[model samples]
Target: MGVYCSKKEVVEAQSSSFIYQRNRTTSLEEQIKARCPNSSANFEDENSHSTKHSSEGKMKCTKVCFICHERVRLDHSCTNQMVKDLEKHMDKDQLMDILMKIKQQVSKDEQSLVPYLHWGTNVALIFNPFTQGLQRTELARNIPEFSRTILARENRIFCIGGQDSSTMKSLPTIFEVDIEEHYRIKDKMNMNQARFHHTAVYDQKYDFIFVIGGMTSNSMGNQFKMLSSCEFYRVQQNEWSIMPNLKVARDTCAACLFDSQWVYVFGGRVQFEKRQLTNVIERAFFSRIDVSQWEEITLQGRQRIMPEFNVGMCHQVNDTELVIFGGKDTYNKQTREVLYFDTSSFSLIHRKSQAQSRKSSNVDEQLSQAKTLQKNYSTAQITVKDFRMPLEIEAPTSPFQIANNLFVLGWSKETNGIHLLRLSLINLNWKEELDFTSYLASDVD
Candidate 1:
């Protein structure tokens, strides 16, 4: 265990539970003094102490991570400090050089390979495969589980808390899975604010995953009223803390990253004094400076005069652009519409979706591509995947069909099936199903 200090002890005006171990024999206090130099250092500065590495190819690396403030050698982690460099000062060419150099280093390293199992007929259904890691699920085998929503960081996938078969709330616990391992949940993580339709966003700049407002009343585990409050999890720190609540108590707001400085969250349902809820985009902001808290954005990003019909389940494509898809519009799930927003232009793009094709056929070549991607280019090719036109599939539908828009998912009551579904996006398509290349159920929380 490490001793605690006020936020002052660490830079960024935040106190962290971890301290660097300089010398095996040295105490924590001395180690801090040695590495941090003067106690009054600007811990948040990116260039506090940097290095230029001349590799065997003699290419110099200008980017560096000052271990004194935030440690970078632990894993393939980029702290808030590192993100600052790329976002603010690093030129495009320099960024490419650095990325290429780093990629080379990574490709040279050796790591274990995770095997995938065929748990079900489709990727959506929970792979009940036996495990070699953390062994447990929210409910017994009688209930079905699927990767309903995944908030992916650099290499980690936070399977946002989902529903189970019974009236009971989903395990109320979120699962953190690594993409390298068929996306196995690292450990069981609980959300104080019981969430269903809420959105979890990974802000690489902030190094935090912000979990925003969602509907809670109908959720079985949510004994509390519906929540408009917000919470955040610091990825590097592996901890969750509550921030300021959203302006409205809502479940199913559309959340998008805005200007890379704030999360533009809006348009969901809010409950009344009588437990009655109305659809409204609870406009608000969640920033890295104080991500745990939220502030309202009053610029009226809502396209709806009445928020009820406004879309929810949004795929926050970027800091400035978000794709709004299907959600409860007055009565049932809206499947006919697709909306896009450009925060820079403050323009909304709406289009009618066509009934797209499913996976055309189980081509051996396609399966080979999946295997090759897992082996050689999983990390190198970090592709953008939003709701896309349905992937063509000739396979028979087994309790599920591809979605027309950003198919925000919900858990099924049955245990044995109904896991995966396809969706239609702008020009391209990609499967949002579980990674069979490297996952197992026991490897989950």
Candidate 2:
């Protein structure tokens, strides 16, 4: 008589719960037979003819579980059960193979959950903040270059115009990096002008990036002509348009956007001048109609920051406040001073008044409100933050916020690699988060 088994019987045998009353010396297959009597079948034949017919029509039965076919059982707790059951049967190498598979699955899951910090340097560096893991990838088309201004939005990092290291020429190149896509970089629309050391600020509401004052020449080795001319890129339109020019022509000026409407340009040096730094603070107001001409902020003696160019690093803390950190002061010495600015309350009041005045047909009232708005720039406040940058770090970039804290990517002369320093908004404490490759600063001009 031939032995035959049904598909349903095999499934039941694999899924059956562990039988506590089973014999301990038997194999798992034998146990399955003990628990599931229907798994294997036998038919007794009284005649030789019946035995020949059964042998000709016999169906093959698979011994392995239908799910996770290599394992003996396919239960809800199969992972743990299989490991325990296989330890005695499997060799050391075979057991290690199973563990490695589990480890890979865990790593894949963690990658999907963690967020990345996309920082642009010669190449884009993607950092896992939680894991402190680092990765680097090249731009889709262009070679990694320096002097580019970086802007982060969502998971994308935009590298604006910068200088070409090899040819010593200013470039209009724009590269967009997607952090989640293995740090993949793709080229975007080039700027209307090629310049470096300019500040790029994004208007979140309008989806426009304003490229402010920078030098027209490469200036890698020598001084270049400073550009007061400014322009902006309309992200949705994929086009660039000229905007109101800066009042003063200068490069390496620190700039940030406030309230999604105001562009503030901090102190910077004049064209071709090394030692002289201007204390000029300019604010440009943006509205639906047009970009109002740039106006210099007027401040009394104690209200002004020390005259320094290229080092006025600041980031917006809120709609009305900003935190400024490490930068060179008037003495041309790098400082660890931290300061906060309470953006002009008068400006906010003027904005509200302007919105209300727009409904009125009185033309004179509208013009009067415009003049009042211009005069309120002096009402802004600046104060020192309780903590400063750690003494070892210097030449910090503008701050970028991740969550509750703000981080600055900086380099140290005393140390070789690039350092990411974090500042807590809650406790005002400074912490060294991670240190990585010096590739970020090695090729800087």
The residue-level lDDT of candidate 2 at 270 comes to 70
Q: Write the per-residue lDDT of candidate 1 for residues 1-445, one digit (tens) a residue.
A: 1111112222311111122232256433443433442122322122222221212111111112334443122121333344355447754345445555554444323111212212222222233211223222332122113222433334344555545535645445666555556545466557775655566665655667777766554544546355767777776676788877876766555665544466666565565343344544334455555653455433344343433543344554423455555444555334324455565655554422211222435344343443232221222222222223222111111111111122333222232222233343212133445322233243454
Output the lDDT of residue 108, model 1.
Answer: 28
Clash count (model 2, backbone only): 0
After superposition, which runs of candidate 1 have C-alpha atoms over 4 Å from their true positions? Answer: 1-148, 163-167, 170-172, 179-185, 215-224, 271-279, 282-287, 292-311, 316-320, 345-445
TM-score of each: 0.46, 0.58
Alpha-carbon lDDT, every model: 0.40, 0.54
Model 2: clashing residue pairs?
none
Tens-digit lDDT string for candidate 2 (205-280): 6777888877666446344677898888877677788788888887767777876778888776674555566767
